[model samples]
Target: MAATGHHGAPLLVVMGVSGSGKSVVGAALAQRLRVAFVDADDLHPPANIAKMSAGEPLDDHDRRPWLETIGEWLAGHDASGGVVACSALKRTYRDQLRHHAPRVRFLHLDGTPEVIGRRQSSRPGHFMPASLLASQFATLERLAPDEAGEVVDVDQSVDAIVQEYVDLSAVG
Candidate 1:
């Protein structure tokens, strides 16, 4: 079956803190939806990458350009549609994205700190360290009632989370 969003074609932003499986789930969602997939991590500036690699959390000033880049990518796909994996941790960040792609919706991967911490620790060679997990959790802002999206718990299999997101997003 052809995949669709609450609207016709969908531009989904798979969002969460680090280790919430945004990349894996976003890729699967894009595949299911038969659309392009882009990981926002790849759009990060070298300075941001260096900061994260050195165990520093980025301030808003450090992230403006990166957010603009991701927002531009989303806007570029306005007609065709796509899915993007992004750590849209703050409400302001998501708002910045919405400015570029008004029709975009989010799939927030929610999880407890313990769950995310374990995943981060087990994972290796990533620019973000497990040490920064706390900061990630602290930075996360829950989606508001007016937000056009759904939150999927990350305790289950990636497939389950993706399925839930697809189902929910299709409904409203």
Candidate 2:
């Protein structure tokens, strides 16, 4: 059965900096929740991908369109529920997403630079380079008290991380 949140359906965003296991954990969580899964990186416009692939950090101007696209996806899935893996590093970005899908909750994957840096190195061909990890971390704003979300440490196994979210969602 699909997971249900305080709302009718659970719209979850697995968010964090690069290399924080957003994709891996998000996909697993979605599977466990029996919800659809989307990696927001796949929704990026070519220009955005090109810019990031070149090792430049994306400014807000570059991210606006992309964020809008992700928001649209969330809005589309509002009733049916879905999980998205996104590097929603800033509160404003998360706010934009929430504006589109008001019932959405976030799962922030937290980890130190050293741990994430090691993971980034093992990712062979991802567009996001390890070189930009610092920028990703610098941009990250932890979930505030008002945010509808929880943070999970990325040092644990993917199953453990996914289970934690599942248990938390069950409680909420």
Candidate 3:
């Protein structure tokens, strides 16, 4: 995989609700783009982890600082961008990530609840247990046309998703 148009561009946020293949597709896109990849989940504070680990959902208050952290990190990747897998379910979250890297674009991994739930149930050893998936869906804010994001349905293979993303993003 080769990165095509990203010689000088802002970072990309491969985002969606939980279990939407953000990590998988983001990794492939990063490889194709020859850029670094970061799992935004790792940026969450212990409190956020603890909350989720305990089968609890985080309120917007809990998400703000974490979003800001991501925004701050984007400063470094403004040029020679990278890809980050993030469950940025809300427009505000995406906005925050873009603040530091205005060229930041989002790739939303859209999927049905049945599809995503099955995918989540198959994975293990993650803080985001399947029990909390309902909360994730409840919190998800669909991408509107006015939103600065590209929606990619997750029914196809990861390669296809990456290819679609690459095609949609001129910077990819």
Candidate 4:
């Protein structure tokens, strides 16, 4: 089945703290939706990647450009849609995407540190280190349900998670 968003060109921000299964879910959602997937990690500049690889967490200043770039991509996505996995840990960052593309929606992946840590440790070569997981939680700004996006628990299967997102976003 062809996938569609709540509005024209579903621009999804698959968000979460580190290790909340953003990449996996975003990839799957993209495939299911038949839209291009953009892992916000991939949009990170080399320096940012290096910083996280060295076990340092990124600050707002460091993340702004990357978020803006992702927002830019959302702004340019086709009429069908797109999805991005990003650790948009702050309200401002999520807002930046909304500001860039008014139609943009966020799918925040939430899970406990233990759950995410185990997931991160199992994953193959990635720039983000498990050591920084706490920092992500520390910086996370929990969004209210009525706010700019939807929060999803990541403890469920990926298909279930994506279906929830797809269903919620399908509501006009």
Error of 4 at 169 (Å): 3.0
Per-candidate TM equals 0.96, 0.96, 0.90, 0.90
Question: Distance (Å) between predicted and true CA of 132, model 4?
Answer: 0.5
Flag regions of model 4 displaced more than 4 Å.
1-5
Report RMSD (Å) for each prediction in the order shown.
1.2, 1.3, 2.3, 2.0
Candidate 2 lDDT by residue in tens digits, 70-119: 99999999887889999898999999999999888999999999999998
Going through the candidates in order, what is the number of backbone clashes in each? 0, 0, 1, 0
Judging by TM-score, tell me the better candidate of 1 and 4: 1
In candidate 4, how many Å is residue 161 off?
A: 1.1
Per-residue lDDT value at 69 in model 3? 85
TM-score of 1: 0.96
**Candidate 3 Cα lDDT to native:** 0.82
Colliding pairs, model 1: none
Score residue 33 of candidate 2 by CA lDDT. Answer: 76
- For candidate 2, the per-residue lDDT at 59 reads 95
lDDT of 3 by residue, 47-70 (tens): 999999898889999999999888
lDDT against true structure, model 1: 0.90
**Cα RMSD (Å) between model 2 and the true structure?**
1.3
lDDT of 1 by residue, 63-122 (tens): 999999999999999888899999998999999999999989999999999998877787
Clashing pairs in model 4, backbone N/Cα/C closer than 3 A: none
Q: Could you give candidate 4's per-residue lDDT for residues 10-63 as a string of tens digits?
A: 677888887789999999988887789988888899999898889888888888
